[model samples]
Target: MWLDKESQIDLLAYSPFAELITNITANERLNPLTIGLFGRWGAGKSTLLKLVEKNIEERDETKKKFVCISLNSWVFEGYDDAKSAIMESLLRTLMDNQPAFEELKDEIRSLIGRINFMKLGATAIKHGMPLVMSAINPATATLTMAQYFSKTKRKEILNDIKQVWNEKEIEEDRDTTVENIRLFRKEFSDLIDKSEIDNLIVMIDDLDRCTPERVIETLEAVKLFLSVPKTTFIIAVDNQVMKYSIENKYPKITEGSEDFSDSYIEKIIQLPISIPELSETDIKNYLLLLICELYLSKGVPSIKANQLDILLSKVKEDNIFVNGIKIDLEFVKSAFEQYDYTILDKGEIDEFEKMFDIIGKTSDVIASILKGNPRQAKRFLNSFLIRKSLAEIYYKTDRTFDYAILAKLMALEYIDMNRFKELYKWAIENQKNSKIKELETITNISRNDEELPEEYRKWSDEKLARWLKSDPIDLHEKDLLKYFYLTRESLDINVSVSDSLGKAELMVFNKILQSKRATEYSLLIEKLKENKDIKYTKILDALIEEFKKNSKLLKKMQPLYICYSEYRSEIKDVLKKMKITEINLQTATALCSMYQADKPGFSDVIKSWTDKGLAQDVLDVIIQEK
Candidate 1:
C-alpha cells in the first residue's frame, strides 16, 4: 500500500541511462573516463545507474562483459581512511566481478597495499601495534640497553643501523611518495587488462551523502590512483556540493583563487551528465502508476495492476521513435482514455479520471513545492496513502474519503504545516457547529449565520481562508475534519491554538451581522461576557461593522459596555475606526452613556471632530444620558 523504494519501476522508461550505457559499452580502448552523473540527492541518479547496470547485464551474452561495479561513498565514509577504503572497494569489486583472475588478484592486492595509510592519518600505532625498543629516545634506549645486556653492547648496536637524517633523504622521501602513486596507477591499469573486461564501469553513488572530507578524499584517490585505462567512473554527485567539498578541502585555493578549485573538479570529472528533474508529465505518470499499484495491491474494485501495465504499453506504442528519439508522454493521456477499465461502473471510472486530472493539473505546483524532487513527491504521496489506510482501518465504517480534497490538503501540509493545522481546526469547528455529522449536510452548503461559531482566531489565516474559499474540490467539512484529525503528525492539535480572543469575537460578531433576522445583541453579548478576558480594543474592528448596520444593537450589548468601562485603551482604536456620519442616534446614545459613566476624556477627542453637527449630536446625546 506504499510507493516502494526508488527504481521499483523505470518510471521515466530508462531511455537516458540506456543510451548512456550503450555509449559507455561502445567506447573502447580509451583511457578511464570519469563521468559525473550530476544531480541533487534523491533526484534519481542512483536509480538511473541501476537501470544502466540492468541494461548492461541484459546485453548480448556473446559480447564482451560490461563489468559494472556499484560503489556507495556513504558506506565507506565511516572507515578510518576514505581514500584507502574507496580504493579497496574498487579493487575488491573488480576482483569479485571476475574472481577467476588469480594473477590479477595478487597484483590488485599488492597495489591496494600501496594505498597511503599514513597520509590518511591511519597507521599501525593507531591499530594497537607494539612500539619497538630501537625507535625509543636515547634516555629510554639507555634504560633498555641496561635491561637487555650492557651499555657497551648498546653503543655498538646504535652505530650499526643509526644514520643521520638529512635534506637529501627528505627529497628522496618526497620522490618515493610520488613514485608510489605512479606505481599504483600502473598496477591498476595492468589489473584492468588482466580482468579481460571491455569497460569497467565504476558507478559511485551517494557521494553527496558523505562528509566533505570523505568526498574530497574519495575523489582525490579516484583521480590520482584509480583513473587508469579501460575504467569508466560514473560519479553521482551534485556539482555544487562537490565544489563546496573541494573548497573545504583546500580553503587556501578556494579563497586565494576561485577558478582553481572549480578547475580541479572540472578536470577530475571529464564527462559531467546532469540528471534532469522529473518533468510535469513524468511526475503525473509516476503518481498515477503508484496510485494504480496501491489499488491493485489492495484489490480495489475498479483498477487492477495488469490494466495499468496495458495502459503503460499503450503509451509506449504511441511513442513513435523518430530518429531514435521519442517524447515519452506524447501518448500517455490517449492511452489512459482508450484503456477499457473492465466492467467497473462509469461513475467510478469518471471519479478516478477526475482524481488523475486533479493530480496532473497540480503536478507543477507539487513539484515546485518539493523542489522537483521525485523522492519527496513519493514520500508525500506515501504519507497521504498511509494516513488514508490508517483512517480506513481505524474507522472501518461506510465513510468515504475524497482523494481530490485530501490531495489538496496534503500539498498544503507539505508546503506549510501551521496553516494546514489552522484550516483543519476551522473545518472541524465549522462542521461541529453546523450540527452536521453526515457528509450531505456538510458539502455544497454555504456557512449560515447560526452555524458559524465563535472563532478561536486560529482560522483567520489569509492563506487558509483563500484555500478554503478556492474550493479545489466540493469537499464535505466533516470528511476533511476527519482526515485532518487522522493525518495530523501530532496527537494534540490544541497546543498551538491561538490564545487571542479578539479574532474569535470578531468571527462571532461577523456571524451575528450575517444573520438574516436581527440577531439578539444581548445573546451575543452574553457569549462575549462568558470569556471575561475579551479585550474591547482588540475586537474594535468587529464592532465598527455592527455600529454601521444596527446602531441600537450596541445599547443592548451589556458585555461591550462593561468592556468599555474596564478596557479604556481600546476606546481610541474603536473611535478612530468609527465614522461620525454612520453613528446613528441609538449608537451615539450608547457611546455617550459610556462617556458619562467612564468620563475617559471622550469630550476632548470628540470636540475636534470635523462634522460639527455629528459631534454636537453626540454631545447632545451624552446630555440626555446624564
Candidate 2:
C-alpha cells in the first residue's frame, strides 16, 4: 500500500535530528563544516535530510539566504568522472535555482567555462592526448562530452581546448591540471564571497550506495576541490561503508598503526550523527498507520476526513492486549473521530481494530526476521495489498478476501517460508482432501510431546506457536487451495492490473494511463530517467493500451517520445518486437515523429506505413532532411 520512498512528513519524528543539523549549519561560524549523517540503508536518512531542508527553510523564512542542493552520488557511478560530475551537477542545480542566482549569471557562466576546460584536460590525460591533440582542428576538436548540455557551449569549450593544443607546447598543457584545480578553488571561493547567499548547503546523499571507485572519487572531489567558505556538505553514508570504501581505495596508505581511513573520516566529518534502528513499537505503529491510510484511500471517507498525523509521536494511551502485543484502539479512535460520530457504526472500527491486532500480533515475528526495517515492513504491506487485489481479480467478483486470514497466512510465510511450503505439501499429500489435519495437532500440541516426530518439532518454536494461536484459527478445516491461489506466482495471473506491479511501477503505470497534459508527461519522463531499471514494457504497454482504447491518449504518448531520449533504444526494441500493424496510423505516426537521422531501426516502421498505402512524398521529405 505504501511506496518505499522518503516520507515528506515527519512520521518517524525525524524532525529533532533535522533540527540539530539545521541548528549547527545555520551559523556562519560553522561554515565549511562537513557533517556526516550516518545510518543503515533504508533507515530514513533521505527522509531525515528532507526534514533538514524543511527546518532550514523555516528558520530562514525571514531572510531567505539558505540555498539547499540535494545530490545523489550513486547516479554518477560508472557513468562519468565523479569529480567533475559533482561539480557539474552543482552548477546545473544552481542555474536551475531561482532566487539570487538570477543576478550571478556572469559568475556562473565563468565557473562553467573553467569546469569545462578542466573536464577537457582530464579527458586528454585519461584518453591518450593524440586522440584529441593529433587531430587538433576545429572539426576534430569537438571533443566528446560526458553530458548532454548546450551544444554551442560544448563547441566553445572544444575550441578553447583546441586553442590550448595548437599552442604547440603539450607539456605546458599537461601541467594545467594542477594549475586549473587551484584556479577553480579560488574562483569558487570568490564566487561564494560575492553572492548574496550566506549558507550554501549541499546534501550529498546515497554516497554509500555508490561503487568504491565512485565513492573515492566523489569524496576526493569534495575534500580537494570544493571546500569553500560559507558552504556546508551534509554527507549521508553507512559508517562501515565509508570505512570499507576508504580501505578499498587506499589499502596500504599507512604502515599499520590504526588505519589511515579512520583518520581520514575523522578529519572530513566534523560532526557525526547516527540514526538508530526502529523499535518494535515504532514498527507496529508504522504498519498500523499504513493500513489506515491504504484503506482510507479506498472508500473509507471517515478515515480520510480525519488525518494520519497521529504518527508524529508515540501513542501514550493505556494499551490493551490485542493478540499478544499491546495495541491502543483508543488512540486509533482519536485519529478517526470528527464531530463525535464513530466510524461507520462499527464496520470501520472492526477493520481498524482487526488490522491493529493483525500488525500488532505478528510484529515481533517480523521484527525478529527482518530487523524491524521500515522499508521491509512497507514491502510486506505492499505484498499483502497486491495479493488481496489479485484475489478479487481472479474470482472476477466483488467479494473480497477475509483480510484477517490472508494477513495471518502471509505472516507465517514471511517468518518461515519453508514451514509454509511444507504445510502446503502436507495439506495436499497427507490429508488427501486439501486439508491439513496435522496443522491442528502441530499448532495445538505442547513442546513436551514425546510422541511427536523429530521433523515436525520446529513448529513448537515460540514465534510460530504464537502466530498459529492468533485469530483465524484451524486452517486444517479450510480448503488450502483457495487460500494459496493468489499467493502462487506460477498461476496465469493478469499483469495488466496494479496487483502485479511494484508500488512505484504501479503508480507510474496509472499516471501514464491518465495524464493528459504535456507538462505532466515531461515530469513523468524525468522520473522514468531517474529509475532506469523500471520495465520499459510496463510503460510501453500502458501507452499502447490507452492509444488502442481511446485513441485520444496518443497525443499524450507522442511528447514523451519527443522529449525523453535516454530510453529510446529500449522503446524502439519493444516496438520492433510488437505487432503494431493493426493500429497502423497510430503506430506509424508516432514512430515518424520520433525519427532521428543518426538513430536507425525506423526503416521497418516506414515500410509498414508504406504497406498501409500512405503517401510516398511524406517519407521522401523526412529522408531529404536526413
Candidate 3:
C-alpha cells in the first residue's frame, strides 16, 4: 500500500507556494515573522510545507543557510499544557541543531525549571503568557532540570520558586514566570549568535488537529517567540477548524465585542498563505501519475523505474496535466537502450505502451465527477483496482475486464449515494430482462405506473436509464455483486453512511420533537418541511409520546398542523383524547388557509370543528380562511 505522508523531497508540483516562501525567506527584516499556511485537511498544506523546506535547502548555498526545525505539536498533546509541549519541543530541537551552545542551554533550562505547570490554567485564562515564560511547561521543565543538575540542586531550585511564591511581592506567580521567560529569550538569542546560523526557521504542523484547548494553548505559546529577532515560524492549520477551536476555547466573549477569535489569529499570523483546492486538470494528472507509478513498481523491472521517472519529470516540467500527451516510441527506445528496453520484442513494448494509453481514455470520465479532490480520486482508483483484482481471483479466468461501466457507476456512487441506491434498485429489478427495447424507461407511460419519490425522480432518467440497458458484466449475480465495496465496510450496496442523518441534524429534529415554547413553532414547521424524506412516523411518534406525557404541549401544537396530512389518523386519535373546544383555534385557521382551496372536504372539516363546540374565536378564524 502507498503511504499517505509527506516526504522531504519529490512531492507534486507546488511552484506557486514554493515561490512565495522563497521570496519571504530571502528578504531581510529586523523582527521575527510568523507566516501561516492555511488550507483544509488533505488539501496538501503539510506536503507544501515540506516542499518549501526543500526549496530553502537547495537555494541556501547562494544565500544564508537557515537552521530549520520541524515541530508537530499534536505529538505531545497527551500532556497537560499545550504551551509546555511546544516549549519543550522547541528547546530540544534547538539543542539538537546547535550542540555547541551548551552553556546557554543550561541557563535556558534553569529558567524553564522555575515555572509551576499546575498554575498555568489560571495564568493562561488571566493574561495568556509572557514571551519567554509562555513557552515554559511544568512537565518538561522538571524533566530537563533533572537531566542537567543533581537531585539536591533541583530541590534548591524548587525551594527558591516556593520562597518567591510565599513573598507575596509578586501578587501572582505570573510576574515571576514572565521574568524567567524573558531571561530565557535573551539567552536563546545569544545562543543563536554563538552558533553562527543565519536564522532559525521553525516549521510547526498538525496544530489544527489538536483539541480546542490545545489549539488555543499552542497559539499562545507561539506568540512568545514572535519578538525574537532572526526567527521565522511557519504554522500549518485549517482556518475553519481554528475558528471553531477559538470559539470553543472562549465561549463567553463580551456581547458587543468584535469576533475575538479572528482578531486574535490576525494578530498572531502575520503573513497568511492558503493552498487552493485541486483543479480538474490537477486531479487528472495526479491520478495518472499515481497509477503509472503503481504499474512501474509492480510489473516492470527495477531498471524501468528510472525510465518512468525521467518521463514523469519531463511531463511535469512541460506542464502536461492531462493524459493525452503524444508518445515518441523511437525517442523512448533510444533513451532506454542503456536499460534494455531496446532489447525487448515489439509485442512486449506495445503491451507496456498500452498502460499509458488507457489513462488518457479514462481520465476525462474520472475527473468530471471526482470534484478535484486528489485523495478522493486516489480512493476511487484503489476501489476499482481492488474490485478488478477480486473478480479475476474469484473467477479463475483470464477473461478481459471492461472497466468503463464500472467507472461510471462508481462516479455516481461517490458523487450522490442516494441516487446510486435508486439506480441499483432499478438495475436489480430488471436484471433478468436482457432485451434493451423491453427495458423499463424512467418516463412513466401511465399515471397508474408507480412513480419514484421526487428525490429519485430527477436522477432516474439520465443516470439510471442508460445503465438499465447495458448493465454490469455480472448481471446474473447482480444481487450478490458489491458495487459500493470500496466505500463500505460490508458488501451491501443499497445503503451507505451518507444515507443517515448527521449528529447536528438529529439534534435539531430531537429539539423540535420535545419543544414546548410557542415561538419555536415556526422553526419547527420549517424543519419538518426540510426533512420530509425522514419517516414521518419517526417524528409523529416522538411528538405524540411527548404530548401524552405533558398535556400542556397539546395547546402549542399549532406548528405541527402543517404536517398533519402524513399522520391524519394518528393526529385524529391524539385530538380525540383532548376536547376539541380546548384546542387552539389558530391551528384550525392555519389548516384552512393551507387546504381550503385545494382540499375537497376542507370546508366540511372546518364546519365539523364548530359543530363539535369550537369557541366563537375559532369559528371566526374558519370563516376568514374560507
Candidate 4:
C-alpha cells in the first residue's frame, strides 16, 4: 500500500500547471499578491502547492532570493482566533529563522506582547468571559474589566504587558487600540523589510478545513496585515468551501441580488488559480503510473524506475494512431515493450502482457467512477492491490485466480456495494457458470423498464452499463467464491466502523439518547443545523440499536428528534426505514406544532405509520395536519 501523502514527483502530469503557477508567483512584479490555489479536496492542491514551493526554491540562478514560509491555517483553527494565531506564528517564524534580525529580537518580543494584549481584548467574550471589549474597543485600549474580573486581577493582567511606550514620553492621544493595530502592521512590515530578505513567500494550506469564522478571519488577516510589498501569499483552499465560509460569516446578502461571497474572495485573492478536476485521460495516465510504480517497488524484473518515466512520457502524449496508451491490445503491447522484458522468454512475456491489459481495461471503469480525482484514483488502486494481496493469501488453493475478474468484481463492489452483495448472493448459491438472470436485461437494455427488478433497473444507468459491458461482463461461467472470500473481511470491517462520529457529534448523540426532557436538546437542535445528513443517519442508526437494546428508553424522543429535524424530505426516507412504534398523535402533534405552514408536508410519512401499527383514529388526526 502506498502512503497517502503529497509527493515531490508530478505523477499526474500536473507539472505543467504547477510550473505555470511557479512562473506567475516567482515574477517579483506580482509581489504583494494573494493567489488562491483552488481545487476540490484531494485533487492534489496540497501536492501542487509543494511543487510550486520547490520550483521557487530551485530558482537560485535568479538574482533575487525568497524567504519561503508555509502555514497550515487549520492548525490555528481550534487553538485560538485566526488573526492573532497567524500574526504570532509569523513573528515566531521570522524571529527564529532570520539570524540577520537577531538585533531586533527585543522589538519582535515586544510585538508578541502587543499581539497577546490585542487578542485577549478582542476575544475575551468568545471564551465565555463577560469582559466587553466591543463596547470599549480594543483599538482604543479602554477595556472594561469590572463586569466579570476582579479589579486587582484586571490590573495585574494589564500591568504585566510590556511598556512599549512611556506615558510621560507620549501623549494620551496615541494610546488607542485602532492606533496599535495600524502600528502593528507597520512594525511587522518594517521587520520584513529590515531583515534584508529579498522577498517573503508564505503559502497557506488547509484553510478549507477551518470553521467559517476562522476561514474568514484568516483571510481578513492575510488581506489586512500581510499584503505588504515584496511579499506573496499563496493560499491553497477549495473555492466552493471558501464561498461557503464567506456566506456563513456574512450571510446577510439578499437573494438574487448578488453572491456576496464571490465578490468578497475576488477582492482578497488578487489572482485565483483554479485546478480543474482531473480529466479522463489524466486519471488513466495516473493509474497507469501508480500500477507500474507499485510493481517497480516490488522489484519486478519486467520494469525499471526510469522505464516507468518512458512509459509515462509516451502515454501522457496519447498518440493512439501510433499505438501509444489506449484501452486496447496495442497499449498493452507498447507497455510490455517499454518494460524491456529481455529476461523473460516469449511465454512469460505473453503472460506479463496479459497482466498489463487488466490494468488498462479496469482503469477505464475506475477512472469514470473516480470522477477524475487523482487522490480517489490512488485510493482505489490501493484498495484493489490490498484485495489482490489478501485474495492470494486467503485462498491459497486459488492463487491462480484471474486478476481481470477480480478487478471487474472489485470495481462493482467499490462503486455500488449493495449491488455487489446482491451479486455475491447470486453467485454463492450455485456452481460455476451459473447465470444471474437479472443481468440478462439490465446490462443489455439501454433504458429503464417497469417490469425489471428494482435493483437491476438502477443498473441500466449509463455508467453502470458501461462497467457491465467491460471485458468479463458475464460472470455466469465464473466461480465468484474467490471474489467473496476477499471482500469478507472488508464487508465486516465496513459495518464495524460505519458510524464513527466525531467527538462533538458523539457528545450530542449521547445526550440525545439519554436525555428525558425535550428542552435538553438545544445541542441536538444546533448540530442538526450543521452536518445534519450524517448526524441524522447516525442518530437513526443509534436509535435502531437503541430500540433493540432498550425499547422503553428509546421510545420517548428518537422519533421526535427525527421529525423535529427540518429536513422533511430526508427524514421521510429515514422514517420509512425505521419502526418508530412511538410515532403516535402526540409525537405528530409535537412535530407539527413547530411547523410554520398549515401544510407540514409529510403526508406519506404519516400515511406509512398505520402499517407500523398506528391507530386508525390517531392516523386520521395526524394525516389531517398535513
Candidate 5:
C-alpha cells in the first residue's frame, strides 16, 4: 500500500491561483481574456492549473457549459509549428465540448480544412514552381518543399497553379497569405460565438519548457485566435524562463521594455497568479504527521499526547526564534503520523539523535536541493526515510532509531562521510559549548573559505563565535552538531552560528533543575551566585570534601563534575545549587596538603577549611582584612 508521505500532499495550501480561476470562470463576458500563471520552476504553476481544471470539471451542470482545454506548446518546434499545433488543439477541444459546439462543428472543421489546404498549397508551390517559373522567366526563384509532400508532375502542376492564381481577383489580392489566415481565424471565432459555448477556458501548461520562438509564437497565437468574446486563456509558465525566451528571440528588445514578454502576455491575460510559500510550522507539522503515520503502519505504538508534547518541546527548544511561530515536535510528528506515516522506532535513541543532527546540520543544503520548493522538501525527506528503511534491512539491525543513522540519511544528498566525519570532529572538539550553536555553525560554515583571506577567516571565526554566544539565543550542541554534519556534507558552509553553547547549556540545565529533583542543583546554583570568584571553577574540591564526609555520595556525583570545568558556566546554576563551588581550588589544596603535610602554610589551612565547607567565606573575610 502506498502511504501518503508529507511530500505527496499539497504542503502549500490555498494558492491564490484558485481565486483567479474562480473570477475568470464566473464572468459571463464573451470577449477573450488571458490569465498568466507565473512563478519560478517547481512553483506549482502546473499543479495550480490542474487544480483549477479539476475544480471546473467537478462543477454542476449550470457550470458544465464552460469548455476548458489544456495544452502544452513544447510538443512542437518553432513558432509556425506551435501555432498549427494550437489550432489543431483548439479544433479537438471544440469537438470535445460537443454539447456546446455541436452545431458549429462542421463550420469549425471547414475552417481547419481551409487552413490545412492553404498550408499544403504553399508547400507544393514552393517545391514545384522552379521549372515552370523558369519557362515564364529565365531567372525565376527556385522552390523547396518539406519531405512530407509528394513530388509528382512538378512542371504541369506549377503551371496550372500559376494560371489559377493569375485569375483577376486572386492576382488583385496581393496579401493572400495574411488575408487567408485572418479570414480563417475570423470564421473560427464566429463559429465559436454563434455556438454560444458560454465560456471557453484554454489552459496552456509548461509554456516555459517551449523554445523561445515557440513560446512567443504560442502567446501570439492565443492573442490572435482567442480574440473573441467569452474566451479566457490561462497559461502556466516560469516568468524568468519566459522573459529569457523573449529576450533571446528578440535581442534588440531591451530589458524593462513595455514589450517585455510578461508585459505582452499580461496585456492579453487579466490576472497574474503567484503561489505563496509554505510557512515553516505548516511544513514541520505536515512532515511530522507523515512520519507518525509511517510509524503506526510499522506496528509502532501510537505516539501518546505526552510523547508528542515532549517532541514538540524539543522542536520548540531547538528552534526558539523560528519567526515567533511556536510548535512542538509531537504536534508535528503526531499529525504526520496520523495523516501520512509514523516515525517508527527503527533504531536506537542515539541513532535517532544522529539523524536529527544530520538534518539540523545540513538544513540549508537540503533547502537548496528543494530550491525553496516545499514539494521538493517533502520528496527529499520521504526518500530519506525510505533509504533508512533499506539500510536497516541491509544491516539486519534496528539502527533506524539511531540518530547517527538518521544523520547519515539526512546528509545523503548534502554531505559525504568524509565531510560528515570532519563536522563530527569539529563538534567533538568544541563540546564545551552548547550542542545547538556548535552544530548550527558547523553546518552553516562558509563554503568560500578559500576566498576569505587569512585575516578574514580569523575575524569571521571570532565574529561567528561571538554571534553564536548572543541572546534571543540559538546555540544548541546537538543542533549544532547535526547542522554541521548535514550542511558540511551538502557543502553549504555559509550558515551563521546564531547562539552560544553557554546559553543553551544553561537553558537545559535550568529545565532539569526545574523538574522534581530540584533541591541539589538549585542549592549549588545559589551558592555559586553568592561567591563571584567561584565562576567556571572545577567542582573537584567540593566533591573530594563530600567524599571525605560520605564516600558514597562523592562516588555518585563525581561523573557530573568530571568535565564540569570545561562547561562550568553553561551548567553553573545547576552546579552552584549542588554546593559544588571552588572545585579547582579545593582540588589544588587537597593535593598540596596530601603532598606537604610537614610543610604547612596558607594553602594547607585553606585546604582544611574548604574540605569542611568553611574556607570560602572565611577566606573572603581574611582577604578583605589583608
Candidate 6:
C-alpha cells in the first residue's frame, strides 16, 4: 500500500533536532560531526533518521550529493564484520551508480581494497588456507572468494582480522587504510562540502540488537576507523548500550582522566538527541491522519472526516497525560480503529466504542509501561494490530477484540506489571478530586458501556486493591498525589472537610494554593474552614482566611503592624464591634472539635449557650459572655 505523507512526528519536529540539522547543513564547517540519537528501545530514532535522509535527498539535485547508509550492526556477528558490511554497503551503492560516481571510482575502489586487504595475510593463516594458492588462480579465486565470504566464513575472517590487527598494525595502516577510509568517507562529505547538500548524514540503526561486544566494536569503528571531515553520523541507539559500548571499547578512558572525561568519540558528536515523550495533540493528530489514509486506501466509504475527528477528540481528552509530555491520544485511537479487523458500518457508535475499547486498553496498558511516549505508543499499537490480525485469521472469529487477548498482548509487550500496579495505586490514592473525576470518566465509559465485556468491567477498585495487597508495590508519593488530584478533578468531587484533614489532601491543597492561578485559594480555604472534620485551631484557619481576603492590604499594613505592636489587640475589639457572640465562638470550637482537638473555652461557651434559653436576654448574655 502506498503511504500518504503527513507531518513528520519525530525528532525533527522537536526544536533541538530540527535546529541542529539546519545549522549543520547551512554551516561551512569542514569537520565531520557525530550525533547520538538516544532513547529507550522502541523510541522512533530510525524514523527520525529516515526523515533527515529524505530531506537530504530532496535537496540533492540543487545542492550537494547526499547518501544515507543505514547499517544494522546486530545483523553481523562482531564489530569488524559490521564495519566491513557497512563499508561494503556504501561501496556497492556507489558501484551501482557508477555512471554518476565515475570521477570517484578509483578512490572508492582503492578504499574498498584497503578495507578488504587490511588483514588478508592473517585471515588466510587463521582459516588454515594457502594464501598464495587463491591469490594465483583468478577463476578458482572468485569461487573461493565467494565461499570464504559466506556468512560463517565472514565471521571467521572478521575474528581473524581482529586477532592479527594490533594497535601497531592499526597505526601502520593509519596512513593508507585510515586515509583511504577518510577519503572514501570524504567522497560523500566533499559533495556536501562543495554542493548545496545540507549534510552527508549516515544513520546507524538497530545497535541495541547487537551483542554488547559487537555494539562496542561498531561504535569504536565509527569513532576511530571512520572519523572523517565534513560529515555527520546520526546513531540510533540506546543510552545504556552506548555507555557500555564506549566503556568496553575504550577501557582506558576513565571518568576523571582528562582524556577520559573528553573521550575522542564523545568529542566528535556535537548533538546528543534524547527523544522525549510526544505531546498528546501530536500523537492524536498522527493517528487520526494515519487512520484516515488507511481507511481511504481500503475503500471504506463509511468513515467521515468529522466522525473520525470526534472519535479522536474524545480519546485525546480522556486518555491524555495532563502535565507530562503529551501525545494526541485521539490519533492513536483513530489508528487502531482504521486498522482494526472488524469494520462496522459507518456512524456505528457501537463500533466506535469497540474500537475505542481496544485503543483505550492498549493505550492505558502501554501508557502504564512507556508512560505515553509517542514512539512506544505507536510501537505498542502496531504490535497489537499485527497480533490481532493473526488471531482473527487463526481463530476464524473476531476474538482478537477480546479483552483477555488484549491483556495477554499487553503482557507480551513487556509492560512492567509491577510498574503498572504502582502507577495505578498512586493514581488512586494520590489523585486530586479533579484528576479522580477524569479517571472516573474513563472508568464510567469502561463500566457503563456494553461494548466492554463483563469480565473486564469487573476489574474495579476492589480488584485493584486485592492485586496491590497481594503484590505490595510501592507507590511514589508524588505520583500518588498527582493522580489523586487529577482523579478528583475528573470526578468533579469537592474536597470534603474529612479529606482536608488527610496528610495527602493537605499537601495537595497547599500546593494548589501556591500555584500560579490561585484565584480559588480563598474558596478552598473557606471550604476547609467550614469542614467540621478539619480539627486545626479556628484561629489559624481564620487568620489564613483573613490573609486571603486582604492579602494585598496585609502587605500594605505589614509596616503598620510592626510600627504598632498593640495593633493585634484590635482583633478582639473588631470582634466586639461586629457583635460576634460566645455562641459563635462555641460553634467554631465545635466545628474544630471534629478534628479531635480539645478547647476548654469553646467547650464552656457551648455548655453555657445550651443551658441558656433562646430569649433576647440569653442572646445578649451570650454575646457579652466572652
**TM-score-best of 2 and 3:** 3
Candidate 3 vs candidate 4: the lDDT winner is: 4
The whole-model lDDT of each prediction reads 0.57, 0.64, 0.57, 0.64, 0.49, 0.45
| Lowest lDDT 10-residue stretch of candidate 5 | 129-138
What is candidate 6's lDDT per residue for 551-596, written digit by digit as tens?
3223222222222222323322222223224334333322233212
TM-score of each: 0.61, 0.64, 0.65, 0.66, 0.51, 0.46
Q: Write the candidate numbers in order of decreasing TM-score.
A: 4, 3, 2, 1, 5, 6
Q: Which candidate do you rate higher for TM-score, 2 or 5?
A: 2
lDDT of 5 at 341: 21
Per-residue lDDT of candidate 2, residues 248-344 (tens digit): 8658746665586787788678889999887766677667666656544223466453344432233322221122233355656654435232333
Worst 10 residues of 6 by lDDT: 469-478
Candidate 6 lDDT:
0.45
Clashing pairs in 2: none
The residue ranges of model 1 lying beyond 4 angstroms of the native Cα positions read 1-5, 60-64, 99-103, 115-174, 252-259, 293-313, 317-365, 435-472, 476-479, 490-626
lDDT of 3 by residue, 317-379 (tens): 655543444334343444343634343333354554554345544555456666656556667
Model 2 residue 178 distance off true place after TM-score fit, in angstroms:
4.9
